[model samples]
Target: MTIKEKADEILYKTGLYEELKTYGEPHPIGSYRMDMMVYNDLDIDILNNSMTLEKLHTLTNYILKTFRPTWYEAREEVNDEGKTVWFHGFHAILMDELWNFDLWFFDRETITKAEAYCDTITTRCHQNPTLKTTITTIKKDLLTKGLYHYDKYTSMDVYHAVLTENITTTQAFLKTHPLTTY
Candidate 1:
């Protein structure tokens, strides 16, 4: 199955969205939103400040027991926007493939700006249809060369390169910005 198909299976069929609704709204972001998915990575943005520390744990517990992911982790960190977030990320072998899920929890105040930024990227990718192809190519090449590390960069960086700047090739991307681990 394609990534979209598997995504739907995991999102709706697994009742992931319904479970998430107990805490807040679940909004898929990044490449998933832009239809530029190059790998088995899913990004979710949860807003409304409804997911408190306690609720976050309860939800994660449910995920752990139900999904039985190979591994999972949680963190509290400040985003690039300087807004603190509760991040619950996990990796699992699902549908005979390894999938990464990034669940970002944010308050209403923080989500407003975050959603707008993601929407802008989605809009830009939609406008320039070719950008999606270029993005997937760049991402696929990076992955093939073992140069694309999730910890080092994000889809936002990729979108920024293709949308704001004219950086295209993986070589150009590497030279233009230091896509390295912190």
Candidate 2:
């Protein structure tokens, strides 16, 4: 199946999208939001300020009961904005492939600013196909070479490398943007 179809299957068919809506507004980010799919992942940020233990428990419970995730983790922390945030991350075997999801739970105000920033990036890429192509190539090349790591780099890094730094190749990205930069 295609990338969008796979996302639809996991989000819509599996009812995760609707379930997330009950708590907050869930939306895509990074490559998924920009339609620059080069990896088996989805990045969703859910906006909710009043996140209660019961709400979290119910959502996670639903996920655990409804889906068979190969890996699952939940954590609460203070974000860079000094706002309390929660993260629900998981990887599941879907369509015979490992699919990763980053479910960031944050207050609506905090997430709105982030979403707006992502929107700017998305719009910029959409308006310039050549820029978008350059971006996806760098991302795909790095992933294919096993250069991307969860603890190291991300698609956002690639975008930053290209859009801001004008670095287009995999080598340049690795050389210019170090692990610490991410």
Candidate 3:
């Protein structure tokens, strides 16, 4: 099945697949075609917290199947200070409030990685109420931490800052939530 078809099937299974066919020509970004695919909003309050595990599993399966992120990077093993971490390796900047994978790019692999990370986080958020709360908290932190400044730009746009080590993977992610740096 095609990527789009796979994604559609997963989204349909979730009963949240509202196809946005208006996305026109793919925007040229480096070596890949960039396009917004399924955009969905899952109302957290409506979902029963007691069955969050089931809900999160379904959501994670949907994303892993839908997006088919082949290059999804494993969680970073350690931090700069040698601290162990799992979810901190990469960052995801969710678009609006939609859980739908709105961002995808072929050439730039980081986009795919970021989407994968977002998918994982969103699933975890569904599994735990505190994670749900943290989403807003982190978003607020981004604004205060000056991360919002990089949200509008791309990896290509900030290639220099990344290569020069001015930003670590975590910092880069914090900046714009991109999964990988150029």
The sequence of per-residue lDDT tens digits that candidate 1 reaches over residues 31-87 is 677667888888888885544677767878998987889989987777797877888
Task: Report lDDT (CA) for all predictions.
Answer: 0.79, 0.82, 0.34
Model 1, runs deviating above 4 Å: 77-84, 178-182
Clash number by candidate, in order: 0, 0, 2
- lDDT of the structure predicted as candidate 2: 0.82
Once model 3 is optimally superposed onto the true structure by TM-score, how far is the C-alpha of residue 89 displaced, in angstroms? 25
How does residue 72 of candidate 3 score in lDDT? 33
Q: Write the per-residue lDDT of candidate 3 for residues 21-130, one digit (tens) a residue.
A: 12211222221121212222121111111223343344445445545443333332444645432220112222222232322212223334544544554454467655
TM-score per model over all chains: 0.86, 0.90, 0.25
Q: Could you tell me which 10 consecutive residues in candidate 3 have the lowest summed lDDT?
A: 40-49
lDDT of 2 by residue, 1-182 (tens): 77866887888998899999998889777667777888788888898887877877887888788778889987778877788888888888888899998898877676678778778888887788778888889878888888676767777788788889988778888889766652
Task: Give the winner by lDDT: 2 or 3.
Answer: 2
Candidate 2 global Cα RMSD:
2.2
Worst 10 residues of 2 by lDDT: 173-182
Question: What's model 1's TM-score?
Answer: 0.86
